[model samples]
Target: MAKLYSKQKLAGQSMLPKKETIAFILNYSKALSIKKIGKMSFEIIAN
Candidate 1:
């Protein structure tokens, strides 16, 4: 179908997944939470 073709083209262009999309997948699918610990350092809390 045309939709499938467009999806494949977009995937080849590396423009389908944005930063937020990746972050959401990692943040929730991994069962982890992100919190502000310091200015630069990051802390991973299990949910």
Candidate 2:
């Protein structure tokens, strides 16, 4: 998923909800800025 984060720096962006599972990301990837809220838990920090 590090690739996703780095890609965000390239200029283009993606729209996203406030929360999503990593598994969903694995299937359909988006470089929305997210932060881990707990072990195996993450939240969309920005759109």
lDDT of each: 0.68, 0.56
Best by TM-score: 1
Model 2 over residues 1-47: C-alpha lDDT tens digits?
24567645556546655455656675455546556666665755343
Q: What is the C-alpha RMSD of each candidate to the true structure, in Å?
A: 8.9, 18.5
Indicate which candidate wins on lDDT: 1
Model 1 regions more than 4 Å off: 1-13, 32-47
Cα-based TM-score, every candidate: 0.31, 0.19
For residues 1-47, could you state the per-residue lDDT of candidate 1 as single tens digits?
35555556554665477889899888775876456766665657576
lDDT of 2: 0.56
For model 1, name the residue pairs that clash: none
